[model samples]
Target: MTSQPPGAHLPDHPEFLWRNPEPKKAYDVVIIGGGGHGLATAHYLAKNHGITNVAVLEKGWLAGGNMARNTTIIRSNYLWDESAGIYEHSLKLWEGLEEDLGYPILFSQRGVLNLAHTLQDVRDSVRRVEANKLNGIDAQWVGPDEVKKLCPVVNTSSDIRYPVLGATYQPRAGIAKHDYVAWGFARRADEAGIDIIQNCAVTGFIRKDNKVVGVRTTRGDIAAGQVALCAAGHTSTLTDMLGFRTPLQSHPLQALVSELLEPVHPTVVMSNHVHVYVSQAHKGELVMGAGIDSYNGYGQRGAFHIIERQMAAAVELFPAFARAHLLRTWAGIVDVCPDASPIVGRTPYDNVYLDCGWGTGGFKATPGLGWCFADTIANDEPHPYIAPFSLDRFVTGALVDEHGAAAVAH
Candidate 1:
């Protein structure tokens, strides 16, 4: 299959050879979860390390999980250095991802502005912007007037509750087409001779001397030299197959899109205090969402009050969006960690690794996550870029606190 190289686009009718490869009897690696991260992990294994004897097991179709449901926002601004490092690495990959994967990911680097609504919010954002710059990440602070100039539709008046005080702007941050990312990674992995088995769910683990050697799936028991569980919201269930436990709590994260209108909202605007985010897609539909459900639940749907308040905040911020017809609303399960960071390292079992606990921020970290995960799985050690987010951090009292920076934008 031939694909137009990046920046060399034709009619976009690239041939595809990726298909349902039956589960193999044994493989060097088996990545569970066929979403963006899983497929990416598989692709990197073959493309980078020449580990082509790999299989990706998915319960559903590729990108059918949170991979497709997310708002597709990408950025690297974080308060902590560790969080900033990996995310910045991810953002760097996102920069050339479409070309590297031979797919047009529709990456628009317009910018991402995190809106501040109160004095404390402004201070917090100011500190974050400074820290981001110090870490060699591009970031800036924009006052209310500059925020309006960036996104003229934003309401900057202090008359309303949680008024727009200012914002932290990342000029390099923006959105990418999520579906292209999924399909692109899948095709690339397939081209590298990696098998992608869909509609197959992992039921249990094959262990020896407390080491996970393989997994028992709906298809059959497939043995592997190593297993990487990239399951997003269902990390706990997958880990349960080994009789182990993690601190992952599943919560509902809801998002909605308005009917297509003329381009009005320019860059992505995320308001943490107001608990809403708005970004105009390439198709002109405004994608909006807010914080996760307050309680833990596995259902892919959340309480209406969460979306209701989100819409209310949207209208308060952009009154013009009030008249915009709501076309569709959906929710995805987000695996929340206690410190609102991600888990991306080895598990208790020697041969098993995990890339879960991303909460709402998994989509943006796809490339970097897979790159590091593939390295970790291949060498049986953690990559320096992803080492800080290891499972031991939870017990080591060295958590990367990104709750305030991530809760609104993911």
Candidate 2:
């Protein structure tokens, strides 16, 4: 097969020789998602660890799932040490994405300001600021005056239901071009000989005795030495096919983008009190997001109530948003764990791995999770960074709770 260099246009790449009705073929590793995490995992496995025989199975176009649907917020401010450490490392990786991937991810270090409304909110922000600082993340407590200086458009003194008191500022926290990250990894992984099989759905797992051997996809079964399920919202379904239960609930998270305005919003503004966050894209559009659905649903559709509530919150944060016309709205399924942390590492089955339950914070963690997952798959052992988020933690009651501050936004 004539292969093209990484990042070359599709027409320049070799035509896919392996088509359906072609039965089972063996692979060293198989990842069950073509989003940023799975693609990044494939890229790292080949680029970093010299593991070339990998396959990424995608049901649709690459990054057509949550990776494409995210609002693209990246931050490393968390209350717990483990969470802080992992995300901070992820942030660092994001900073150098352009150099590593040889494609500009367009990382904007525009800063993230998480607003505190109540006196209790202010206290919680202070504690979180201190915690993030202790973890060596650039987080600081900013009062109303400082908050105004950072985001002059915000109405800090408004007599709303939840009045603003203070905020936690992280200058290093920012956003990146979400699609570019996914495409960059996909292109590089493809160049590294990782078979990216698109329009393929995994039907079941091929098990030998107590161990998983490979995956049975809609296209056909592929014999894989090891299988890693990175299927985000559909994580539980895939695990169930393998005869294992996952402690996860899938919910729909909605986000909206406004018509291109004249670049007013400079910083990412998050409000725990109002339960909303907004940031402007490079194209001058304002990307706004809010909490998930009250009830769980497999449908990716969102409710009108969420849009109304988000607009109300946005207007409260920045009164000018009331005049800003909402251009489009979209929703993606978020796989949430009971503790709001991801489950990563080897499963009870030998040769089976998992990377799921990321909820809303998964976008920022793509690089970190992918790097650790690649190491785990290549070395046949879970990396220390992912040990705390293992599936066994649920049964053992070892939950890394980030409920106070990181709850809403993440």
Candidate 3:
């Protein structure tokens, strides 16, 4: 493949390029995706292991996929052991992202409250809080009085659809700037000599004797010693091109941002019984999200009814939000596995690594997933943190089930 002329604009760089640099024909590792996880992987591979011969391929602009489209809520209150441990590590990384990257990720430790409206919901919240606490995360069950004191705008009184009994509160759970996180990682990775290739689509894989040797992209063919697939929603499609079938199904998940208003919503609030979660952005815009689309589709479009249902639920939880008009709505495709957990290890192929099936919790897992995935790629063995999410679990029924907690937007 012919390399681009010297002093060309890098794919992940958003601004104009004063000077273009020549592209290398090969790399030690090629990561497919410029999203948060992909960029983070490149950063760790270079900074942690001194692996600078790396390239990240992106079909569009950097972080144009789920990484930039998420609501940016970060937390570690999962009910399952495997998920809780991994997410806790990710949260710890987020706490120091600004200092580590030298770019402000704007991580706000505003805390998160998982509201329990029914008896069963309360029981589940209590159980998850205990699980998270045992995993060294700050999660606790709070009574109605405590919930009201934390979020006075919420309607926690009785006579509601799902009366608020209590909630699980995580003081460390909060929000971050999604775009900033992606850009911070991208800039740092680029500075470390990792090529960030944008507008590059991986059409096929080059394999010899059942081992992936390189990737064929829209730009051109690039040889690599190892290839890691970090494409989130397009993971199944990419795998199919490589002659493998994944159990992932892509679905559209929608979220909205309301017009700027006074700071009323303090903490992130999620309700399982209502299937809604709401948090206020740093700009005073109330960002809200609901469950995934019922059917499977590659399209990122959602019907208006989805947002309407979510708005109604939000208003029901916080009556004061009744007048907050929504400014815009957006959608993103999520690759959901059968068990709603991720698949993050070697595939059937020898050298091809898999890092997909994030479902709805991928954004918060950027750091931890990258840390584990880099280890898997470097050591040629799945890390203990991600061993439970292997592809073999599907057939062996060793699923790391987090459907209960994730259903309510954990």
Angstrom error of the Cα, residue 224, model 1: value is 0.9
* Lowest summed lDDT window (length 10), candidate 3: 1-10
Q: How should the candidates be ordered by TM-score, best one leading?
A: 1, 3, 2
Model 2: per-residue Cα lDDT over 1-410, one tens digit each: 24333453446433432222233398889899989889889989998899988889998877889998999999999898979878998899998888898776788999999998878888888999898888899999988899899999999875777777888999998999888788778768877878888888999888998777878888888898989899999898888888889999999999999999998889999987788999999889999999998788877878999989999999988998889998999999999988888999978898999999999999999998899899999998888888899999988998987775573677
Residue pair clashes in candidate 1: none
Give all TM-scores, in the order shown: 0.96, 0.94, 0.95
Off by over 4 Å in 2: 1-24
Best of the candidates, lDDT: 1
245-321: candidate 1 lDDT, tens digit per residue: 88899998999999999989889999888889889998899999898988988888889998889999999999988
Ranking by lDDT: 1, 2, 3
List ranges where model 3 is wrong by over 4 Å.
1-13, 16-23
Candidate 1 positional error at 158, Å: 2.6
Q: Clashes per prediction?
A: 0, 0, 7
Instruction: Show pairs that collide, candidate 3.
Output: 6-20, 7-19, 7-20, 7-21, 8-20, 8-21, 11-198
Tens digits of per-residue lDDT for model 3, 1-410: 12222233345444532112334689999999989999999988887788889889888877889997889989988888899878988998888888888777778999999988878887787888888878888988899899999989889878888888999999999999887788778878888878888888998988899888888988888998999999999999889989989999999999999999999889999887888998999889999999898889888777788888999999999899898787999999999888889999988888889999988899999988888888889889988988889998988999987777744664
- CA lDDT of every candidate: 0.88, 0.86, 0.86
